[model samples]
Target: MTISSRVRLICLTGALALSVTSLPLSWPNPALALSDIKDITPAPPEQDPPATPAPAPAPGDDEDLSDEAFPVIPDPDPLIKPSNTDESDATTPQEPAPEVIYDLEKAPEPVRRMRQLIMDAAASGDIQALKPLLDVGANQTQVPLQTSDQDPIAALKGLSGDDEGQEILAILLDILSTGFVQLDKGTPDEAYVWPYFAGKSLALLSPRERVELLRIVTAGDVAEMQEQGNYNFFRVGISPDGRWKFFAVGD
Candidate 1:
């Protein structure tokens, strides 16, 4: 073979190989790929679904806050109130008292008997009879040195400063004028004479006068013994309990 012919045949073969290799690597137009994307499956929706949104609450609804939700509370001290009430109930008001009245007519029996004995002695001056009577039972009542009209006890009260002896003398005179007298004895069945005098000559005298009169009576002095007999029927008065003795001499 000739050189020129063989060179042309080899060049032709090389050119064919070059063209084949470059053709598959060339870029296509974007407009031409739109149809191809439409045909594709969209990649199966990205595998995970979207998260669900939370629901909204209703407006204006009120909440229940009742006692069943809590509990009852009690007082720590209960007795204090009742104790105060009891103290008030226990208090009570007191009543006032009444006035008293005295009745002398209702004087005790013992005091009456004592007064009677004194009256008898002053009236009779009967020494013998009084001795036997006093032996049985008698009581001499003490005579105060003030008049009943003068409030006896109050008049003789120490505040008055009156001599007790002088007041006592006045009392003896008053008693003699009004208090007692001895009756005169007479014939059988004769009515009694109201002499208003038995033997009162020695009745109203001081202690010294009484002693002198007693001596005169004992000696049978006619002037002193004329009014009453010398039998000396004077009182030997004693207390009801026999606690004392008294002698009244007769003229």
Candidate 2:
């Protein structure tokens, strides 16, 4: 409460304020200050590097891959696999092949002699020469004519382009020159037909047989006959008993 005591207290307070003001103001070191702060933010999530894309394939690579995945199959052999054409159908009925005989000695004596006589008459180039062989009877030689009652010799003349009937003679010679076939053996219908094609199927001919057919007819003619399924040309037939059965044209 005395003046002197109060003055001393004031002086002591002033000295304390001056000491606080005179002291240097220093900031904390920057690196040490940041380290002092609490790390509240969550650490960034761990991340993987971006993946690289695969390279693209070159041209034709897809085809090469496909070939490796599925191999190609080859076609079957033709000999092993038959075609399904109608001509080769197994269900179709085939004609029985006739026995073609080329050697004249195989024929009976009567048949051989009669054939030779006919050949001689045909080679003579005279239609009338055939009249004697064609007698009027039940066993008489049969010929293609308009009427059954017509005279065989006269009918032949009418058929020929020339009056001498040389064309008919040539046709007879051509028909008898080839091979012959025996049909319906030991039966009343049995006969030896000239130009074996008369009793054989044109479709079933061998290469050599086809050549024989070509000798008597043209390729176009043979093709047409094949379509018709038989030989259609001049033919001569003789019975086993040596009788000249027929000289005709047609199936």
Candidate 3:
């Protein structure tokens, strides 16, 4: 039934009850009236306890009270981003190309002597002596053509600055003394080695590059400590089979 009808029925019931209670015992059907009662609605759920107001403050008290008890917490400072500019600039470096490992103690007399010659040339600013030594482990085809002078040392010496010449020779000596090289990107039988820095190609070498050449050889080095022969920028190439190809130093 509609809610209004139900409410009316309830009102009528209440009225009849009141009237019956006031009626005298002359009524013939009082029991029948109650027996016919129908469709009584359930009692409304108990109402929540009335919210109590906060106790009034004393007349002399300094602090005033509130009806609500929820603490008024202050908002936190705006979230801040940490300054990580230096950390961000500290990017993870690329893994180094494998080096040529050399053992001077066990090296053959000729090899040791060759290493010494290159070192001496570099120390004395004489590229002439280091010229032939450069080709020891290198392929002939990779050598640059000299139109006027076939003497590799003289040609190299004539071409380089004093300081750069030494640096170039030092790098070559390091390569010549290398024991083995690793080509992470190449297979066991075949790997490409950039004797010069990949950043500096043969066609584009500066006068400072001296007689150094480009991709042609591979040879890894031997060091008792990690930082002994480490370089941030250099070119040391070798064949996958452990042959020296080209070697150069970078700025």
* Candidate topping TM-score: 2
Give the whole-model CA lDDT for all candidates, comma-separated: 0.38, 0.85, 0.48
Quote the positional error of residue 170 for candidate 1 in Å: 49
- Which candidate leads in lDDT? 2
What TM-score would each prediction reach against the true structure?
0.17, 0.60, 0.28
As a whole number from 0 to 100, the lDDT of residue 188 in candidate 3 is 44
Q: Using TM-score as the measure, name the better of candidate 1 and candidate 3.
A: 3
* Weakest lDDT window of 10 consecutive positions for candidate 3: 217-226
lDDT of 2 by residue, 1-251 (tens): 99999999999999999999998888565575776899899999999998898677787676344656877788767777667766576686766788899999999988898899988998998788898777468777777788988989888888787898898888788778889999888899788999999888777789998988888788999989988999998888888888888887888
- Clash pairs (backbone) in predicted model 1: 125-233, 126-233, 126-234, 127-233, 127-234
Global Cα lDDT for candidate 2 = 0.85
Which portions of model 3 miss their true places by more than 4 Å? 1-117, 120-124, 136-138, 141-164, 170-180, 184-232, 238-244, 249-251
lDDT of 1 by residue, 2-48 (tens): 89989998988899998888787656855756556665655664656
Residue range 1-251, candidate 3, lDDT tens digits:
99999999999999999998988977585465756888589989999999999888889886754647656677887789666899967889977544433345543355345445545766775655555556542253133335634654544443445634664565555544334333445454343333323422233435443223222222232111113433323444444433434443432
Error of 2 at 58 (Å): 43
For candidate 1, report its TM-score. Answer: 0.17
